[model samples]
Every structure is written in structure tokens, then in C-alpha cells.
Target: MNSVNNTDAAKPAAGLSINKRSRSWWSAPLREVLDLAFPPRCLLCEVIDYSSNSHSGSYCSECAEQLCPLPINRCLCCGAEIGLYSMSENGCTHCRHRNLRFESVTCLGMYEGPIRKAILAAKWSFSAVPIRSLGRLLATERREELQLLKVDRVIPIPQHWRQRVFRHFNPAWIIAEEIASALQVPCDAHLLYRQRQTRAQKRVPVSQRFGNQAEAFSLQDMHVVDGERILLVDDVLTTGATCSEATKLLRQNGARECHVAVLGRVLDSSA
Candidate 1:
């Protein structure tokens, strides 16, 4: 459902690129039609009135102002804060010891507040609206940071068949499509496939999270990613183990460099 090239999942609704649509002549009328049918409500606060929606298409301006952006001095590699980053002046300590595969990471914000609630809704509420709202926000806000990744293509972290079935929606894939669309880059939802199903990271210990995802992803076509600068997108990043394992294998298969873009990131301690 997440493949941008497939036209089944990645293809957004009839009205999309919500930000871009705001400028079009038909946008106002279309929005009025939707508001009448769907009755616009702020994605964050669930307010009925849309006065603040003029400032934020999906959320109220108050919640929008409260969105916590990632600090400026994050670890250039993992998108972690300076305190959590295992890095030094010379290089990253984790990379030196654990050998993480991705070269860098970027994200919209730390996992908290409305972002957290929206993510939970996406995962458990059986609704695509929250995902679409968050995806558009990410696309509108993070374009410059995504561009600085110097990526050749975008890929979502793959979900195992069972997980995909259980969840019914892949937020990672949805979010990746947003980033890809904004960057005008190719998005391959099937770039990586789950070789086997494993327990969700939440069910495993923090120390074992990395191992749980080890050997989990197999590239759909090795040659497609060989020597490519790939951007792996995910919903939330906590331990960084899952992305690390995927990166390691992708690079072994000849991916030149793998970077990550995530919607939300929770520190290991807090998570």
C-alpha cells in the first residue's frame, strides 16, 4: 500500500499536497465541500471550529506552536540530542563500537504531545486521516532538512507481513511518500521486505531491540539500491537499532550510504 510507484497506496486522495492546494482557485471551494461533509476538526485538539486551521490546515495554531522541534545541535548522524548522542569531536562512539550503518538522520521533532497522540491514532484508530495530516505537515516543514540529506531516493522501513496485516496501515511508508513527494524523488515502498516476522520492539527489551530486527530486511532488488544514497523513513525512532540493522544490510548489498528521516524520535531513556 505504501509504494509510490504502485499508484494504489502512495497515491494520495483526490485532493492532496494540502499546502499546495491552499493556493489553487478550487481549493477554497473544495475545502468548503469537505468541511460540510466531514466537518473540519483540528487534528491535535479536536476543536470543531476551523478558524485556527487557516494557520494550520489540520491542527489549531496553539498546538502548532507547541510542536517541539528537534534541537539544532543534534548528532549529525543519528538525529539524537547532544546528551543522548554517543559521539565525540573525532567521530561517533556508537558507530565506532556498534557500527551503525546509516551515515546520518533527520526528523521533524521528538515524540511527544499531539505528535504522539496522532501517531497512536494512526497505529490503532484504523484511520488514515491522522497519517495524512502528519505526512503533509512533515512534507511542508522538513523539506530543507530532507534536501540536505543529499539523497537519491526514499524508502520506508519495511513491515513484516503479519505486522502489516495487524496494523492495516504502514505509517512509515505513508510518511516516506510525503518526504519523497516534496523532494521530487523516487519512493520505493517495496525497496525492503521483511525476511521474517519478529516480535514488535515494544515487546522486547531495549538491549534486545537491535537483535530483534537483525537480519529482518531483504532488498527487493539489490541492484536498484546499489551505490544509491537512500533515505529510510520511519514513524518513530527510539533505540535506533531497527534502522541500524536495515542500513547495515543495505550497505552490504552495495548501497553507497543510508540516511534516515523519521516523523518522531523518543530518547531511549524516556521511551
Candidate 2:
């Protein structure tokens, strides 16, 4: 009994020693200063600052609740929200019209409201701080879907080299990294590559977006993707042109299966 008490007493000191030894040489002081200088704030609702409070990430509890996660009742192939008019097996008519290479797509949330503002704020406005919050929200929201897939690898939708250089950061990569961390999967940014830049899809006609993207991306290394079950990730899905082209490339390179996961999906007008 005395020996057990002594051992228990020593354990806390040992733990404290380990913690002291583990202090990061680079981040400890820097993070301390950062916290002191700029206290963390919620990206949405700006009401409850996160500096003093502890919630998972940037969004306040209110905004977090407001976020509408992608509904489970969606078209299996295209990830479109299914309505009363939709079919059960094949999903909506739009997916039927276009043959896609990936097995299916899972989106995290709706593109409107807070989710949209958060994505645009970080993606276009170049607010790096908000990325962590956005990523956390995405990871938390899609926990169930990610668990179901048991994804082997998380692949960020590749960006053309020039575009990556111009932007200085890739939005898709950030989101993919968060999801990968949450799911304990390998995040393979190099598995796929955008070999060349197509003209901007946003400025082009809908027909041209498909044509242009079909020629945009290519596989970087066949070995990385070949025979692997991949979860391709992107910030948003609009016409599905980009993901479709990427999926086609992965299939051609010998990937066993490709599944897409995005932060949001543009609602199909036809649906």
C-alpha cells in the first residue's frame, strides 16, 4: 500500500517533467505573444470572441447551429439535394444526363448564408486566420460521412502550378488537410496534379467549362493513386465539371475508386 502511494505521487512529477520537456522551441513563445496581441474571435457572429472562451474553432455556438450540413437525402451520384420529385435509385435527372467517373460525392454544407460567407472570406478575401475555423467546422459537420467511407487517402483537388503560385495558398488543400486530420487518413496533395491551366471556368459559358476542364488536369504519379480508394476534396462544387474531370483522370491512372467530398454543392436548377 505504501509502495503504491509512492508510485502514484511520483507519476505526476514525471508527467510534469515530460510536459516541460515537450515545450515547443519555436511555437511556445510565439503563440503566447499572438494570443496576447490578438485574441481569437469567432469568424461568424463576431459577438462571442473565442480568445477567452473555448469552443472547437472560430464559429460561435449560434452560427455553428445555423450551418445546414448537407442533407443525407441527396442524389447518390451527384450529391444534389433530393426532393419529392426525385427517383430513389439513380438520383436526379441531371446525374443521369451526364456520366461521371467518381462513384459518389459528399458535401459538408450548403453554400448559402454563413457557410458561403466563411468560404468566401477565407477563399477569396485572403483571410488566413479564418481557415482554421472553417476547417474545424467542416471536419465536425462531416464526421459521420467520413466515418462511413473509411477513406484511405484525402486528395485535394489539384490547382495549376501558376494559379497556386499566384494565390500563395490552395483553398482545397486547407480543407483536405483538416478532413484528413479528423479522419486519421493520409492527405496526399501530390497524388494528382493540374498539368495545365484552362481558361477561367467562371467567365466561360457552361458548355465551355466542361470542354476546358476536360483538358486541364493530369496525374502526377500513377503509383500514388493506382489501386487506392481516394476521397477527392474541394472547397465547393458548382457545375461539377472540375471534379468530374479530376475523377476521370484518377480512373484513367488506375485508381480503384474515387469519391468526392466538398464543402458545398451548388443547387441544381433543374432539381
Give, for candidate 1, the lowest lDDT window spanning 10 residues. Answer: 88-97
lDDT of 1 at 100: 61
Q: Highest lDDT: which candidate?
A: 1
The true-versus-predicted C-alpha distance at residue 83 of model 1, in Å, is 5.8
Model 2, 1-271: lDDT tens per residue?
A: 0011222345664567666577667666877676668665676666646443433346667776776553657778877777756664664765676666777888765577777777778787565556655765777787887778876788888788878787857878877877877887878887678778888766777666678897677665776677878888888877788888988887787778888888777754411
What does candidate 1's lDDT look like per residue over 54-138, in tens digits? Answer: 3333666666555545455677766655656345443343333455667777776767776777677766657766776677678
RMSD to the true structure for each prediction, in A, is 5.2, 8.4
User: Scored by Cα lDDT, where does model 1 land?
Assistant: 0.75
